[model samples]
Target: MQRKVDPEGLAAAAFLAFLATAGLFYVNIMAAIVDGLVSGLAFTDAQAGQVAAVNTYGAAFGAAVSIFTIARFDWRKTSILCLVILVAIDLLSILSTTPMTMIGIRTLHGLVGGLLIGTGMGVIGRTANPDRSFGMLLFVQFGLGGLGVMFLPRLVPLYGVAPLFLSLALFSLVTLCMMPFLPDYPPRSVAAPIKKAGTVQWTPLVLAISALFLFQAANMGLLAYIFRLGTESGLSRDMTSGALGLATWVALAGPLLVMVLGRRFGRFPLLLAGMLLTLGGNALFHWSQFGEVYLLANCATGITWGLVVPYLFGMTAEFDGTGRTAAAASVISKLGLASGPLVASMMLGGGAGFAELINTALAALVLAMLLMLPPAIMLDRSARRPSELLPQGKVTA
Candidate 1:
């Protein structure tokens, strides 16, 4: 039988997935957010950092909770509730006078955002082409996030911190209005006998999760310090900032490739190539005293950053029909992101130079790529096997 395609449904799902993952993108723009708090709210740098940390920690915890609840609730209804609550929290944040109050409000906001994002990923896992969906997720995030990072801080100087909170509130409200367009995305039915027989492949799942964690940690660690690395490498602040911004916009090509190519070359080959480029990109930091090398390094790393993440998410999502694995991976991702800057801070505090920092990042990336290989190879092998040769109810693409 020929199936009718719901173009509107596909568009709505893609839009919601983009909106729902704003919490993760907010981390990508943490500098502007922290600066807004410091300049507009008159909070000290330490207090602003505390609020951001609390928010990230809260989101991670919320994603952990979602790992258990994804299959129990209606995704559309839950998403609507989360959006409403998030809007309310953002509105409430503007009224917070004390650092503690702001921290508390942002924590609540993060929890709701986390739930929304986790549910969104679960829905993506259920889709026929999660790689493309995840590619779209990164595409929207980088597109909007580049704008935010570039311009949001300018508003803080003129309009106070209200614009930051207002922007977030407005985004959630818009997503809420679009909620009616979303499919219900009810939980899928897993094969009961496979569950009973305990046939799940734990090894590859664990490896993939660990790989994602390391990938995030390595990238965030380098990103958190990229500005300093650039300046110390003899580049001016303006030049570094310009290069970073342009790199961000140029990085859109990576996800665009994923969306267009899908899995044409298989995950393992794509991942290996991406990681190799990442290694070369990091290595370029050694010659960053030359302005062109610095710019190229940032652009290279940025493109690979956009490339590997969605593929990793897509890989993890393939492990389970129920999407629980993807939810759990979201939690790991948040934790890794949160930990990255902390690790970087410790290294800098210990009097380590940028050279040492670059080495550490390179090591983490190498480890991440190694961790990803076994699972990618396993999935590749599974894909090549004939359907009849595989165990019943255990087929994967």
Candidate 2:
């Protein structure tokens, strides 16, 4: 019933994903700028935290919107609208001088950001290799985030954070450039089970999804707050940035390794390996006071993240399906995105220090690890076998 998968279409999906995540990374930079803006406006840290929450709330709501939004509107129109909304909002962020305005703009951002990530990711996942797609998508996230991080910090001084978002407006414009060539709908060949498998269980997939939440929550938390923590511990802004910007790029290794091995293994093992690397990185950052130590920690984090995230997405699409599968991920992604700052606020503030943050993260990660054991026991041997893991995971009806 379906036709052959288009390689070019898949490639376009990856590029579009790159751009969407660039917007997210831009927001990440904006998070820092929001703090700076808050300090300038005399808002308490609590108020600043609230401003960040506005974006998360928007994202969570927007993600929910995607489930209905995509179904009602065509992907093409939806994408263009999201970009248009983001462009206006980013520029507005530049104009914002007060907390309320900032909150309003970020809330808008959360909404649009959620839509872009949800839909854009769905496109790529449907097109690319499912097994490798997971690693591949995260690969794009890191690359885009890196590009945004490099450019946003430089732009913030010249035009401010809002203007930096305007730059995202420019990047979103690029997504349009690819649109004429990008695939509008999932290929007819993408086999989706309609009845939710009345008797067909989804325990493995559920476990994988849960693992995704834990991993992302843990990873994003470090990404959001580590710069502040490192700076507090005597690292300069540039040093922290380098760790994030340069060292974070090192995360590419996981995916690259997966490219070679994805055809050879299961997503869960790769996921497990990624978790170990993340654990190691966090430990390194915890023990070392030196900037280089944190630098090394980021490198480890980067590589593992690159692989783990894509693998998770790919696995999700396989167990479930891509269209709405990506929509489901947005729930945890949004929570983790907002949770990082809030968790940090609770853990590190009031002179309670980094101990709480670091300890809590390590503890959660352990819990995440514990969560994975069930899948190991329940999934099939081939499902667990490395050589059997297909890089792609589209439903083959």
Candidate 2 worst ten-residue window by lDDT: 192-201
Q: Which whole-number lDDT from 0 to 100 does residue 220 have in model 2?
A: 61
Every candidate's CA RMSD:
4.7, 5.2
At residue 122, candidate 1 shows an lDDT of 75
Pairs that collide in candidate 1 are none
Candidates' C-alpha lDDT:
0.74, 0.62
lDDT of 1 at 31: 56
Q: What is the lDDT of candidate 2?
A: 0.62
Model 2 ranges with Cα > 4 A deviation: 1-15, 27-49, 125-140, 154-163, 180-196, 200-206, 267-269, 314-326, 349-351, 380-397
Per residue, candidate 1 scores C-alpha lDDT tens digits across 265-368 of 78889899999999999999888888889889988998998888878877786665444566577788888876665576567656777788789999999999
Please write out the lDDT profile of model 2 over residues 1-397, one tens digit for every residue. Answer: 3232354456654666654563364544533544345434555554566566567767777767766665566776777778777877877776677777888878888888788766665555455454445555566656666665544554444455554556567777776666666545554474443433232226766776787777766666556666556666788656666667776467677778866776365555666777787788888877546978878887887788666665665555555533445557668666766766666655544555665677777777777767764554444354555334333333421
